[model samples]
Target: MKNNLKKNKEISKEQIKNYFTKSVSNFRNNFIIISLSILKNFRTYVYVILIPIAFLMIYSWYTNAYKGDFKPPELFKYMVIPSFAIIFLVNTTVSEWKNSVFLKRIHSAGISRINFFVSLYIFNFLLGIASFLISVTVMSIISLIYFKPSNGTFFSLLGLLEFNDWVGMLYSLFLCISISVSIGVIISGLINSIALSQSITLIFVLFSIVFSDCFLPIDLLSLSKPLTYMSYFVPHKHSVWVGLISASSQEVSWAFENPERPGRIISFGFNLWIPCVTAFLYSTLLLVSGYFSFGWNTKK
Candidate 1:
C-alpha cells in the first residue's frame, strides 16, 4: 500500500509538470503565430499609424499658426494614442475572428482558446505600444521644428521632464492602451462581423474623442443629470486628464469640478493618485470581461 501511494504521488507530480510544460510551449507557439499574422499585414498598420501623425502635424501647425496657449501635440496625445490603439486592435481582432481557416488551423494544432486569446492580447498590446512610440517620436520632431510649446514650456514627447512626470505620462499611456486592447478583444468576440465591428469601434472612438474631456471638460458641458452621470463611466476621461495634466508644465486653467454633480471631480493640483487608481480599476474590470467574452463561437 505504501509503495503504491508513493508511486501515485510521483505520477501526479510528473503529470503536473508535463501540463505546465505543454502549456508554456503552446503559449509560445501561439504568440509566434499571432505575431507573424499581425506583422504580415504591416501595410494596414502603416496607414493607420500615418493618419494620426498627419493629424498631429497639421494640428500642431494650426496651433502654432494661431499662437494658442495650449500645446497641441501634448494635448492631443491623450486622445490620439488611445484612438489609434483601439482602432487597430479592434480591427485586427475582428479580422482574426473572420478568418475561420486560421482559427481552425491553430485549434487543430492544439492551441487552446485561452492561449490564443492571451497570445493575441499580448502581441496586440506590444504592437499598440510600438505604434504609439513611433507616433510620439514623429510628433516630437514636428514639435521641435514647426511647433513651439506655449510659454516655452517643455514638450511632452521629448522634453526634460522630471522622473515623476515621466512616470505619470507612461502610466497614463499604458493604462489607456491596456483598456483599449481589452475592450477591443471583448468587442471582437461579441461582434463577429468585421465591418460591423469596425463601424462600432469607430463610433466608440468618436464618442471618446467628443466626450473625453480633451476638447472640453465634461463637467462644463450642460448635460442632463443622467447624461452627466453616464459621462463618468467613460474611462478615457480619467486617462486623458492624467496624461494632459502630467504633460503640462503650467497651471491648469480650468476648474476640474462639476457644479451640478459635486461628487464628480478631478481635484486641483498634481494629486493624481486617485485618478490613476480609478483607471487601473476600470481596466482590470474590462480585462476580466474580455477574458470571459473572448474565444466565443465565431460562427454565431
Candidate 2:
C-alpha cells in the first residue's frame, strides 16, 4: 500500500510538471476539444440541421447572382458568411465554456494563465484554417453544381468574385472563426453557466449580422458608418467580406442577361484588410483574456 501511494504521488507531480513546463499542450487540448464539440453536436447547428435549406438558399442566391449586378455565387456567399459566424463558433465555444473546466483545471495543474493563452491562440489559429477549408469545400461543390462552370473562368482573390477571391474568402473564414472562437473562450472563461454562454453567443451572432454588409450595405445605410467601423472589430465582417469576394468574382460575369451592375463593386468600397487584421488581432487578445479568466482562483 505504501509503495502504491508513493508511485501515485510521483505520477501526480509529473503531471503538474508537464502542465507548468509545456503550456502549448493546454492550448492543443482546448483546440481539440473545440473541434470535437463541433463534430459531436453538429445536429444542433443550423448549417448541419438545415443544410438542405442552406443548400437551397445557396442555390437560389447563386442563381440570382447571375444578374449583371451580382453573380449567383457571390450573393450566396454573403449569406454563407454570416451563417458560419452564427453557427460554428457560437455553438462550439459556448458549449465548451459551460461544460469544460478548461481554465480552472489548467491552473490547478500548475500551468500559468499567460502560457495557456499563448498556446490556445496558436491552436485557435490552426483550427480556423481547418474550418475554412471545410466550409469552402461545402460551398464550392454545392454552388458549382447549380451554376455550372462558365468558360472555365478562374476565381481571383481580391476581385470579390474571382477564383483568387475564393481563396481569400477561405482565408477570411479561417480568420473569422479564430476571432469568433477566441471571443467565445473569453466569454466562457468569464461566465460560469452554459445558459449564459448560449445567450452571449447569440448576442454575438446578432451583432455580427447587423454589422455585416449583406443585410444593409453601408452605401444604403449611411448612418451605420460607425457600426460598420465597429464591425471591423468583429470577425463576422471579414468572414462575410470573403464570401462577398467569392460571390463578386468577375470572371464568371454575375448577371446572365442584365449587365448594368458593375463588376467588383462589393470589393471596391470596403476595406477588406481591416476585417482580416482585426479578426486576427482581436482573437489573439480575447484568447489571452480567456486564459487569464480561466486562471482566476475559484476556491474563493
Candidate 3:
C-alpha cells in the first residue's frame, strides 16, 4: 500500500500551472496519469477483468450451438449484450471509492470535480464502445469456427445499424451504467470500503436482472399484460433493449404458432425502432436522477 501511494503522485504544481496556462488540451494539461490510474486500479484485478471475458466466451459457445444464424443476435439481445455491458461499464462508477488516500486527496485537490467526473465518464464511454466492438468481434470470430454465416447471416448483425444508429443505444447503456455506478460510487465514497461497493453491486444486479426482460421472455411469462408493460420502464431492462438489434429469440415461430416448420422472420419496424427510442429515454431519466444523487449524497 505504501508503494502504491508513492507511485500515484503527480508532477509538481509548477509544471501543471505552466502547462495549464499554455493550453487547455496540451498533453501535460491532459495528463495520462489519470488514465494510467484508472487502468492500474480497474485492470489490476484478474478476477474483475476475466469474469466478463469468461462470460463472453460462454456466450460464444451458446451462439455457436444455435441452429439459425440470427439466433446469435437473439442471444446477444437477451443475454450477452446486457451482461457484458453491465460488467465493464459499471466498474467505472461503482468501484471508485475503495481507497481512502486517493479518494480524499482527489476530492480535495481543488480541481473541478465535475471535470474530473466528466473525464472519468469519457473514459468509460470510450472503453465501453471498444469493449462492445471487441466482444462482437470475438463472437464473430468464434462463430466462424463452428457456425457458418451466409448471405444476410448472423455476422451481418454487426452491419444491422450504422455507428450513428447505435449512438442512442450506446448512450442509453452508458447512462444506465453511469447511474448504477454513480449510486454505488456514492455509497462506496461515503462508506469507504470495497466490500460495500460489491454489496451494492449485487443488489443492483438483482434489481436489474429481475426488471430486465432477459431473465424470461417478458411477453411469454404469462403475467398480466398491464404488469408486464409496467415493468418495461426499469433502467437495466431499458439498457438491454436499447442495445438490441432486430432479432427474435424464438426457435421456430411457426412451429409454436403454426406447429409446422414454417419460416420465421423478424420485423424491423417496431422491433428495432422501439428499443432505440425507449433506451435513450430511460437512460436520460436515470442519468438525470443520478446527477442529482451524486451531488446530494456522493460527497462526504
What are the per-model C-alpha RMSD values against the true structure? 4.2, 8.7, 10.7
Query: In order, how many clashes per candidate?
Result: 0, 25, 0
Q: Report the lDDT tens digits of candidate 2 across residue range 1-300.
A: 999999999999999999666656666665675456555665534443354346445555644633323343444443354344434454455456446575456567775556555655555555445544455555545445444444221132123344566576566655565656566666666666667666877787667755665444433333444554566665566656654544555332341232234432333244455555655666567555656655343232
Residues 178-264, model 1: lDDT tens digits = 778887877787787777887887788667755665444434543445555565578765676566566553234332333345444
Colliding residue pairs in candidate 1 = none
TM-score of the candidate numbered 2?
Answer: 0.58
Task: Give the C-alpha lDDT of model 3.
Answer: 0.49
Superposition error at 285 for model 2 (Å) = 3.8
How many Å off is the CA of 122 in candidate 3?
A: 1.2
Report lDDT (CA) for all predictions.
0.64, 0.52, 0.49
Error of 2 at 234 (Å): 4.4
